[model samples]
Target: MIREVQEKDYEIYMELTKEFYESDAVLHPIPESHRKAAWEEVMRSKDYVQAYILEEKEEPVGYGLVSKTFSQEAGGMVIWVEELYIRSAYRGLGLGKQFFSFVEREFSSMVSRLRLEVEPENQRAKELYEKIGYEILDYVQMVKERNAER
Candidate 1:
């Protein structure tokens, strides 16, 4: 079953986030303190940062986080899929697509576009994203780390 995340599910969400990041391509895990702060921000936001939990017999098995962001140039809301993951054992059963479809339907009224980023090395995830109609953004995402000492 899939449902919106509740405050009671915070621990499960944190566990899943940690497990997914540790097992996958995630470069850094959000510190416990930072995670708490970030989740507080999410909960307090007027526009929702919604999370969907997939459960089996009342235990959370997977989750996805979707949020809406308004585009100034486009003048419409964009649905950003911040994270999606299904436990390894539960993959290949179409749950991921179902999760995406749920997000599409839930935000259809507000969203003008759907957006997500996938690591180049994660071919499985890339294939799934493409299969669901997400195209690669042609521009490379460049970042410069600032040093406090500098």
Candidate 2:
């Protein structure tokens, strides 16, 4: 089952997120305190950043975070999935497909499009995403860090 994230799920979320960051596939590790603070801030803004907990047999198994914004190109709201992670023990069980299915059905009328980023090297995830009908955009993804010193 997929449900909205709650304060009670914080510990589980943190544990899974730490594993996600530490994965050899994704080695960007945020400090524990920083991650906690960021999670708290996101939780406080329900309308902007939506977080959902994925559960099985009433136990939290993973989480998905999405942030919404108006996009001129889409001519309506667009939601970008910032993070989606399932516990290693629970992987390969079609949970990711279920999560996307839920999100699409829940937000179909409200958003014009859904978008997510995947590491180029993570072929397993990329294949799953493609199977789910997400096409790769032609444009390159570029980012400018706002807090970096000029």
Candidate 3:
């Protein structure tokens, strides 16, 4: 089951996010302070961020984070899925598909498209994303650090 994340779910969010960042799928560790601050911002900005707790039998199994921005190419708002992590043991149970379906149903009317980034080495995740109708773009994605240190 999927439910909107609540203040009481903070511990689970932190634990799952730690596991995700520590996994081989991630390229490097993001600073703990940055993660905490981002989570706090998500909780505070409901209009800009949408997060949900993925549960099984009413217990936390994973979580997802989504944010929106205007896109001229998309002709309006586009949703970016920043994180979607399911417990290693609970993978391959179609939870990822369910999560995508839930999000699409919730935001399809407001956004022109949904986007996410996945590590090239994580073929399993890539396949799941493709099955859910996401396609690889020909252009490369790049990021430029505006601050020398943060």
Candidate 4:
């Protein structure tokens, strides 16, 4: 089952998020303070940022975090899926598909598109996403980081 993350899921969230960042999925490791602040933000349940914890028979299995924004090019709102992580042991069990389904069901009414970025080397994820109707967006994505810690 998929449920919005709460304060009680802090440990699970931290564990999975750490694993994700440490894995080959992300570009670099994030600072602990940044992670902690992100958790606090998720707990606040803001309109733009949302987090969800996936469970199996009441046991936490994985987590997903997404951010919302308006996009004129998209003609409406876009939900950018920032992170989706499943325990190594729990993969291949359809949890990834479940998460996608949950996203559409929970936010399709308010979103024009569901977007996410994937590492080019992560063929498995790219294939899964493509199979689920996510097309490759050819635009070059660039980021300008501020001096403040992320």
Most TM-score-accurate candidate: 4
Per-residue C-alpha lDDT of model 2 across residues 37-142, encoded as one tens digit per residue: 6578677886678778888899888888888889999999998887889887888998899999988998899999999888889998999999999998988978
lDDT per residue (tens digit) for residues 18-73 in model 3? 88889887898776776787689878887778788898888899999888889999
- Candidate 1, poorest ten consecutive residues by summed lDDT: 141-150
Against the true structure, candidate 3 reaches a TM-score of 0.94
Better of 1 and 3 by TM-score: 3
Candidate 1 vs candidate 2: the TM-score winner is 2
What RMSD does each model have against the real structure? 2.9, 2.3, 1.3, 1.3
Q: Rate the local accuracy (lDDT) of all candidates.
A: 0.79, 0.83, 0.87, 0.89
| Of 2 and 4, the candidate ranking higher by lDDT | 4
Task: Write model 1 residue lDDT over 50-82, tens digit each, in one string.
Answer: 777888677788988777788876579988898
For candidate 1, report its TM-score: 0.86
Clashing pairs in 4: none
TM-score for each of the candidates: 0.86, 0.90, 0.94, 0.95
Clashing pairs in 2: none
What residue pairs are clashing in model 3?
Answer: none
The deviation in Å at residue 78 for candidate 1 is: 0.8
